[model samples]
Target chain A: MKQLVIHPERCTGCMQCELACSFVQTGTFQPSVSVIKVHVFDEQASMAPYTCFQCEEAWCMTACPVNAITIDNVIGAKVVLSEVCVGCKLCTIACPFGTIFYNPESNKAFKCNLCGGDPACAHACPTAAIEYEDSETKDWVGPWAERLNESFLTALAGEPS
Target chain B: MIAGWVGKVLKVDLSARTHEVQELNLRWARDFIGGRGLGARYLYELLQDPTIDPLSPDNVLIFATGPLTGTNASCGARYMVVTKGALTNCITTSNSGGHFGPELKFAGYDLLIVAGRAASPVYLWLCDGEVELRDASGVWGKGVWDTDDMLREEVGVPDARIASIGQAGENLVRFAAVMNDKHRAAGRSGVGAVMGSKNLKAVVVKGSGSIPVADQASFLRSQWKKKASLRDSKGRQNFTQLGTSSTLMPINAIGALPTHNFLQTVFDGAEKISGERINDDYVVAHKACFACTIACGRVSKISDEAGGRFLLHTSPRNWKMAGEGPEYESMFGFGPEVGVDDPEAIIAAHWLCNDYGMDPISAGATIGAAFELSQEGVLNGTEGVLEWGDAGKMLQLLEDTAFRRGLGDEIAEGSKRMGEKFGRPGVAMVSKGQEFAAYDGRAMQGRGLSYATSNRGACHLKAEVLRADYKDPGHEGKAGQVARTENQISALDSSGLCLFLNSGATYDDYIAEFNSATGMDLSMDDFVTAGERIWNLERLFNLRAGITPADDTLPKRMLEDPIPTGPRKGMVSKLGEMLPEYYDLRGWPEGIPSQEKLAELGLEAIA
Candidate 1:
């Protein structure tokens, strides 16, 4: 399933994503409405982008009293259904990541739905900090270490392989 | 109905001790947009008499917010403080990015128009729709940070935001700045002095309401995408990493970083005072305004080189504070401008300016001018007080100037006035009575022309040609480039977006955001045209104030003195060569706009 992934180191803390999200979801520019948040640690000279982790055993999906939340099969994104949402805010409390939020204007719970399999946040990102990738197909780590190990082995074999 | 707009105008008359509230004129809001543009329109309407003293009760200070401010938009926490400039004696509008703007929006007011004079020192407090004028006698004499803290305590709300002045403004320093959020400031054009003139101490705001937008869903979605884009942008990277000081090396490399009071183009110790050095030496923490995703602000400190044998070490003033910046200009102004390449000295001077409440640009320029005069034996009786590269003496001068003490009294009046007093008016390096920012116009002709012709005088942020020229410095297409950039920048400033956003977004992107927010069918042409109209209006204001075509020229030094070294060696700004072309492109005859063009811009009657 396609999942939204972030390379936090690449984040510049511009908050263009927050603006984009708030504009799309609420039709106004308000950071409170943004699902994705960028927290900056100035002392360290770094910025980290946080969003819905989209866990396998999602606490929000199971905690919804009226079953208002559902997981999308194509993108593995947990989405909120306004029609089913009773504004109970149970999912917001249940979610450990605090990504799921209740919109005061709509009185309904809202979370990242991965923008229908083509997330606008990723699309608009100038630095390609965020990407939508097939979690199962793509190797998330170890490539660099593997390449280094292979090079060391080739050196031991006395060949430029 | 934009979510953030309060749709109201708050008017206060200090002389009468009266206040009134009025509905914001939707027509004006839609046409002029907001912030600087709206404030300009209001100022034009209110101040018909061109001779009104900038510090008099007759003068007006208007704080205005655009349609985008307080919205969910990125970097939308901007507001304009508009008044007659104490520095230039012309139209001065300074914008600051902080929670104060957003809080003002939440208070359900689009604009705060303060007019007339107060009987005594007072402050205006606004809580949502509740407004009152209270005595500020106790905090009147305090510095910006102290006043802010006192006001916050008095209001008993830690979240309450305050914009106040310091000793410089109280002493009527021509280049005083209006500080807010402890460090952020409406930091140019002497807005603070104007406030001090009115006997107003501070404007405190506490807002707890939300801004309503036309479409919540769409705005949220767009905001998210914009956030992501900005988070990854190269501009954002540079800003986040090095703050605005990132421009130091590039500008220095291009010989645009003004050195030695702009008498030289190259600084041999540029790297020592560069952004990388700042990051490595004294960046204590990164700071950001409320809702700002791009945390470009730095709260830095330097304590390594204290108690040293320096001119300023008459008393050990150990420096440790988290001020907003030593942005590229400040670094240049406090660093090479005075021939002091020490980063510690630069940071100390920066700290003193913030603590004492002075505009770094004006202060630095004045000191630079003084250093030059001293070097030439022009200031013979000053007792070696004005030495180049003497950081301690610089700090001492800054203190004296802020308080208008002895020699400080002369320097406090700004370089233009001081230079005239010293019988070297031509060497003062000012236009419209305001001092130059950090860019040496000799290196970049376009920037030189921009500085010469800028309504507020010698200000780079007013209109920058360096960004355009960075790609092609020698391009003759610079006139059009300046015009286009000036127009768009005017629009953006009016729209309440941070100018830094221009690094990642174009006019089209801004227009898109504007259309989505206001639901106005504004085209790219309309947007640019509005900027043109705004520019013309400012020009008309200056002309009405008796500033003529002759005033639209570079400093004699910038025009005649060729840079001694660097890539721009032997180069002088050809402002005279470019002015006519620039004037023609601006739809003006010679250096002044024609009556026909004025009429087309709805400025004929005013002119």
Candidate 2:
């Protein structure tokens, strides 16, 4: 099955993925509504896109009191139903990865659902940092990605990364 | 009636501490559209009083967002600051990219106009149509990054996007910029100096209000289709992989990259400071601004081994710690223009510009002028300190300029004034008091004309006729190309899309995005005309500001100096060959737009 894969080192943190995700899900171009969050760690000088890992235990689904969070059988992705969600944000706190977010605008917990298997983030990521591939996908890192990774891992002076 | 616009303006009189909500004239909006164009309309009207000084409280500062801004349209994170420039004393409309424009739109303003100076230093706090001038006493002296951080904490909104000036602005550095998201700046024509003159520290905005689209179905479809097209574009890929510094080598090869204060067109250290080198050595990761698919912004850190023993104690831990960019223009400024070969020095200089909030383009160009001045034995003892390729001295001067210290005081006046003071005005390569962008006019002939005729004074982005210029040299059919591109870019800049979007998308793409957003059926002809209208209006404003046909000529060097080396070795910018025809085509009789021409664009000629 195709799954969302993130190569954080290759991510430029442009947030195009987030903007694309927000537009696809919310019918509006708002980063706050995006399920995929690009965290820019400045001191380390890295950008990492974090989203639902589709945990084997499904902790968010188990933690939801209303059972609003459900796994899509077709995509193997967890999605929050806007109508069913009570905005209690139990799933937001329950997720170990902190991928699920409490959106105050909608008052619902939203996480990446892989856009029903066609993830917009992957489609929008120019560097291919975020991609949609088989769960057993091999690391087919592009030359540019390799170059970016080398630059990212290169230490300020001789300090070990 | 436009779906993408708020259709309202916030007018703040800082002197009175009062604000009034005013209905934006839709008639003007129809003609000017929005962003830079609409903002230009407002600034022109605001300055009807001839007595207002560009640096005086009477001179208004406007923040305007375009129709396509805050949309999912590719590269839509654009907003404009329209004011009389402290540097050029011309009507300057400087544009910036970041999250702030979108936040302002969400806060229920299509534009914000501040007139009259505050009694003391203050910041405009904006939240969902509510506006107030709050005392910024605590944050007055801080740099842009610290001010942004402190404002977020004080305003009690962690996500509020802030556009603030730093020590450079506070000190009235001629090329100081209003910086947003720390590194992204409206970095030209001294808009920040205007901000400083008013005692205005920052403008903070945040809101949850949604920007309604006229046609969601079509908008999404076009956005998706364009995103796919952008994904496959080679130009976008290059920008993604290498950042803007990628232009260095090729521009150098073309004999266009401004080097050693325009003394030479090529730099020997081109390879050392090229984008490829920056990518291999200094790059931490590629980065982006709001909604930009092309992550051309560089996230780089200064190497700990650079022996930059000098430190600014007043700065934050992350000041020299980390930063974004040293784009080709700024890189050209800090690298070749100033003769600094060390990539680490360029990185540190980039960080200093960000923290101090100065325009690297103007700052570097100024420093280059000083280097040239020192070489001529004008500032003899100081020549040793200000000599070319001295990155340490360059760094010190950058700080000094920000705070207006010692020799920094003279440098703060910018290249033109400094040159005049030192009796070497010819050494200063500037037009209308603003320095040239990285491209030497000698090689890029079209860019030279664009610089000479630029409404914002020697700015590259204003016209950006590089592609057409490179493809059609020998001054053949270059005027029409620049005129059309200028008009079209005016439209695009008004629409609030990134200029780089022109790489992957055509005018057709711009028309589609804007029409879909606003529920308008604007033809390509209408769109192009709207741009013309905007350009003419800006021309009228400049004419009123006393920029005559004489001001529309390039520097003496560009007109006389042939390239000493490279592909275009014998070439000098033949701006003289192009101007008469360009003026005729622009409908400017004797270089000022005629009454009949203004009427053709549906604009009332300025009295």
Candidate 3:
């Protein structure tokens, strides 16, 4: 499974992620439509983007009395169905991360659905701060290589190749 | 059904605390395009009082958004404030990019026209379709940052964008700007002073709305294509990495950088305060305005020499010493132009300008003039106020100017006035009362011509033909280029697009996007003609304001003094050679637009 990994420090707070997400989800270019929220902390000169974590036992899914929220088997995303949604405030209150947002325009609750495994935000980010990485991939620079082979190549290059 | 417009405007009377929604003038909209052009048209038409004072409540302030503003258009994050500037006493159209413009557009209005004086300090709170003037007494006399912080809590939405003035505006500092998103500013003219005069502290807005475009699908595709192009652009990349300070080293190398009150062409301390050094030493992070792909905004933290001098600086993030800027202009203004090399102090001064709500370029240039006067001993009235290389004194003067204290009072009137007050009119490095930005006009012919002809006095962004001006060895064909570029820039500025984005997008791309967003079948001639019409209208406004053809001139220093050092040595502004050609190209009767030219550009009524 690939997951969106966000390094907030690397983010320029351009909100390209929000715009990309909004266009994919709502067929519009509104920041409020985007599931991903970039909270600006101007005084500190920092910005942190927040989105649904897809908790193992999703609070929004469990708290939905109308059964509008459900987990997708393919992507493990806790998705919201606007048709089934009653615009109830319960799921929003139950969510711990405050990632689940209710849209006034649609009168439904919505959160990040990972764009069905190909999130537009990760693709749109100019800095690659938001990356759709294979979860199993190890944290290393350049292409992954075995330690002995990498050491041999590094030795051959006479520098950290 | 113009696709991009919200189709309405809010006309607010501060005196009555009342607002009325009216249908946007379609004829005017069709003619002016939007933003600066549209705003200028509104100001020119609506301002009926013959003897309206700039700081008086009669002088209207128009906050307008372009058709592409708040749309998915690349760099479509700008809004402009148009008014008669208190500093320059000319038609001032100040442009700024941030969340505010987009938010204003999202709040369902194309323009906000503010007029009349309030009985007390108040702020306009706008949400969706609702608008009201709320009491701002608590936020009164506060810095821009503090006001924004308090207002957000009051509004109970952290995401709401606020544009506010600081102590400088409250004190009616002539060069005060309306600071938005904390640091992003319409930071050139004295628009803030007009706001102050009206007793309006800020405008708070939050919009949970979507833009209804002509065709969403095609618009999205167009935006995507543009974004892809921007991603690959080399200029965009350099801007993101180096910020506007990217030009600092190059200009310094060419001897075009304004140094020591425009006396020297090159600076001894230029390298110390150069972009490379600042980027390496201080820039801790990068940020951006709303929807900006090129995140040229810098976040720098400076630890004063003896540890933290500014503790918990009351910034939004509550950082001890973090702020946006010391961008190229402010850096030059406070650094080499004032003969100071302290980058940290420049950053500190930049932070002060943001907080206090003043244009750093004008303020710093004004201070540079003061320093020059102090050195000459001709400043009998104001002595011992400033000295060369005195970063500490410059900071003090900045604060004083914001607060309207002592010699800071003199500095607040700007360089032109400050120079005269001290008995040296020749020392003032200004064009038509406003201080010029970085770049020696002598070394850059186009800049000299642009400065002289700029409607809003001595602004570089009016038509920054820096490359053509800098590299061109002679003054041939410069006038036509400057005039054409100025008209183009005027058109571009009227659109809710950043001129910086022109690096990646071509003129055709701009035309396509404008046509796409507006659903208007505007040909290239129509677009360019509209720009010419808008430029002429602005000129008419300035002309009506009593600025004559004689006012079209470079500063004495640029016209008389030769470049003393660096690449373009002994070169002076050959404005005399270019002025005639420029007038001819503009179809102007001796610098004043001819009636035939005005009618050709569809300004027959005004003509």
Better of 1 and 3 by lDDT: 3
Instruction: Give one digit per residue, the lDDT tens place, for model 2 in B1-607.
Output: 8788877899999999999998878877777889999999998888886335788989999999998888767788899999989899888889999789988887888899999999999999999867889999999989988888889999998778899999999999999999998889999989999999999999999875667778988877787778777778888888888877888998887777888999898888989888999888777777777777877788776655563443544553475556787788878989999888888788778877888889999999998888888777788644274767888888888888999887788889899899999888998898888999988887887888888899888988877668766665577677887898899889989988889886676777678778888898899999989999989888888888887889987778889878788777878888888888899899887898878888888886553
Q: Summing lDDT over every window of 10 consecutive residues in candidate 3 chain B, give the lowest-scoring window.
A: B306-315
Tens-digit lDDT track of model 1 for B340-444: 888877877776676567888899889888888777777875548576788877877887888898778888888989998998886587877888777777777
CAPRI quality of model 2:
acceptable
A92-118 per-residue lDDT for model 3 (tens digits): 999988989987778888889989999
Ranking by lDDT: 3, 2, 1
Candidate 3 local Cα displacement, residue B165, angstroms:
0.6
Clashing pairs in 3: A43-B316, A43-B317, A44-B317
If you assessed candidate 3 against the hidden native complex, which CAPRI class would it receive? acceptable
**Model 3, C-alpha of B9: deviation from truth (Å):** 1.0
Best by TM-score: 3
Residue pairs in collision within model 2: none
lDDT of each: 0.78, 0.83, 0.85
**Candidate maximizing lDDT:** 3
Docking class of 1: incorrect
lDDT of 1 at B386: 72
Q: How does each model score on TM-score?
A: 0.82, 0.91, 0.94
Q: Output the lDDT of residue B259, model 1.
A: 80
